[model samples]
Target: MVTGKAIVLSVLVTLSVVVRTASQLPIPPRYDGFVYKNRISADSVLVEAFFDPLCPDSRDSWWPLKEALRYYKHNITFIVHPFALPYHNNAFIASRSLHVANKINTSYTFPLLERFFRYQQNFYNKPTLQTSPATITQQIIHFALEKTGNSSFEKFVLGFQDKSSDMTTRISFKYGCSRAVTGTPYFFVNGIPLNIEETLDFAKWKSIIDPLLAEQAQAYT
Candidate 1:
């Protein structure tokens, strides 16, 4: 019998080939404000993540990841790429919505992602089995508008339909593929992929980050 993980992996591999056949897309932009803020020094550790918006693992990882990003704010640079897995029914639309949020306002990116994580259950395959794509898109837009008050509804709707926004989302997915990301909540630290199989926690994050930060503090002193 095919295991659940095997089935998911099979679909992911097949999807990767399909994406490779399509036009190559850019590496999704990283949050660059950290550089301008003088937050990143030569010693700063870079943490990059690829997440599926409707993925349960991604949602579970968000809290611990956010904590590390916050507590080590000055010592690390964090970038996230939204990768929509083929297995999740609305993952593409939700990921596309993130690009639209960024287009509307860069600051809206993580907030919208966080909101997606919170409301992810509603968009799961079973729950949304009967839901239309248009309805799903509207729900995502509505959720986005709720957290970020006063954002233009028209712009959000239009952005959703724009080719560029959708391309960017697919680009993000393809970007993750280039990195050989096979599953949700994949992570790399300082360009090295973390082969973690267990749940990530504060202690585990510090285990990787603190030593690097310590060396940085020592080197600068």
Candidate 2:
């Protein structure tokens, strides 16, 4: 026979355990954006990276990120979200091009991104005058034409130059904003924000990510 106070205390303790367990559970991957599904395990941790092609910080982080992805390719699923920063003159066009290219051919996504980052500085005009959006779009179209030699892709790019493309770009930007992303090269692991500093260090990233994978493995076992 327990007193009412003891019964209430027991209920609270049980609820706390339930809450903690739920908080530790892995979050399902988002529907939007590219998802590199893991071949090893469906329970692999999810990594969401928000990047701006024109951002120097994002460019700096790209190599380390690729290394980590290559090393942990079996243990994690990666997704990329383009967040165009307002300060860059051609950031919007760069991001929109990537999005549209992905739609046209998923294979084109990474090569185009690499090209943008490789020649990022060339895309910007003098500090006194910004490049026009139309010019930037044409540059991207030219890149696609040269890479694929697909006249259909050129037609698609020209046709996509409207409010719809603007809306799509805004939607992608807002998705990052809603997640409290204030800058490029931001990352989330298992639905939690990962420190940018840690992201730069491959060893630190492995330490942080390995445990998550192990935990997921234990859950399956």
Candidate 3:
């Protein structure tokens, strides 16, 4: 459930092109799990990551985050939400494509995400400044279809052009707004926002997540 005030603030976020902090926004009313549940008792941690498909910072975070996930395995439940920043041109297309991928094949979503991050440079403001939206759409369609492998091209295009894609992408943005995620790569560990000012590595992430797992293990006994 989104409040009127938060809705208004999220609108204001798009009026500017620069990425800004949204500390003033109220904490969202709810945060149900997007992926796996907690590791232990009520006091346990749930890792939730909000990302923009075309944001570089979000791309940088994925490496360390993936490494940490590999190390922790089933000991953690990490949820990923795509929060496409408005300032980045065609970001909505990429984000919407994610939902389309999920509809076609949930398993393809991760591979599609990796492809988006790797090729983000191609879709940036400057590179695509002269490019038309139709052309970009085709590029995205091709990229996504290739990732989906045997997925029908017709279905891919149909899903991409569906109104539901836009709605789902907007829902993702609004969800991020509810969480006061004003910028890209917003992360919350156990509902507490992580400081991402510095580059994060597996060690840095482990320093935080390892303890939570340890505490959960201690309590499980």
Candidate 4:
């Protein structure tokens, strides 16, 4: 999240108009074993969020994000783009884990991701405590098993370890680099960057988002 006076500056930059609609944009490249959500057809505002699982700031933004989601709900569709910052080794694993969950089904992915975010603060405080990828995978598996009550958790966990997940991780890196996104939690609303300073005072951000969502709502009517 952009903060302090920088928030204003960032929001100003974000509001810079990029003259392209969702239909004009190319289909994002699909990496092997990866599932991409075609958000343009969803009848909601498209929000693409670039995040790192281990980043404290990313975790910090969760409450506000949830509030925003609730405030918009069906009026917005959020697509999470994984940006695994390498310094936090576990972050990449978390991203790949989401890809693995996505492979099985879209419904499972969001719940599991919410679970992961719930534990993010604990995970961040004890980076060394994560042990191995297998350990992390098991933790996620247990969470899924309990939440979904699925009997196939063991098979799913094993599948989650596949090397093919690397492709989506690479795609994330490339997308970030191309967009000049050097930080975690970068966001785009309707493919337009927000201009924090110019367009997003704390009060203004919600005002801007609400009207765009209203426009999307009207488009459907």
Q: Which candidate is the best by TM-score?
A: 1
Q: Candidate 2, residues 81-200: lDDT per residue as tens digits?
A: 889998877788888887777667677777778788887887765631665667667777787555555754755565466565566677778788878999989999889998655337
Report, for all candidates in order, the number of backbone clashes. 0, 0, 0, 15
> Which parts of model 4 are misplaced by more than 4 Å?
1-43, 125-130, 195-205, 213-221
For each candidate, C-alpha RMSD in Å? 8.7, 9.2, 8.8, 11.8
Query: In model 2, where do residues sit more than 4 Å from their true spots?
Result: 1-30, 36-41, 125-130, 150-153
Q: Between which residue pairs do clashes occur in model 3?
A: none
My TM-score estimates for the predictions, one after another, are 0.82, 0.76, 0.79, 0.67
Model 1 has a clash total of: 0
Error of 4 at 170 (Å): 2.7
lDDT of each: 0.82, 0.75, 0.79, 0.65
Candidate number that wins on TM-score, 3 or 4: 3
* Model 4 worst lDDT run, 10 consecutive residues: 31-40
Q: What would you estimate as the lDDT of candidate 2?
A: 0.75
Candidate 2: residue pairs that collide: none
lDDT of 3 by residue, 1-221 (tens): 99999998888877553444543333333342235322333454678888777999999998988888878777667888888888999898888888887777667787888899998998999989999988898888888877887455787789877987777777778878877889978889988998778768899989999888888889879
lDDT of 1 by residue, 115-186 (tens): 989989989999999999999999888878976665568889999879988878777777788789999899
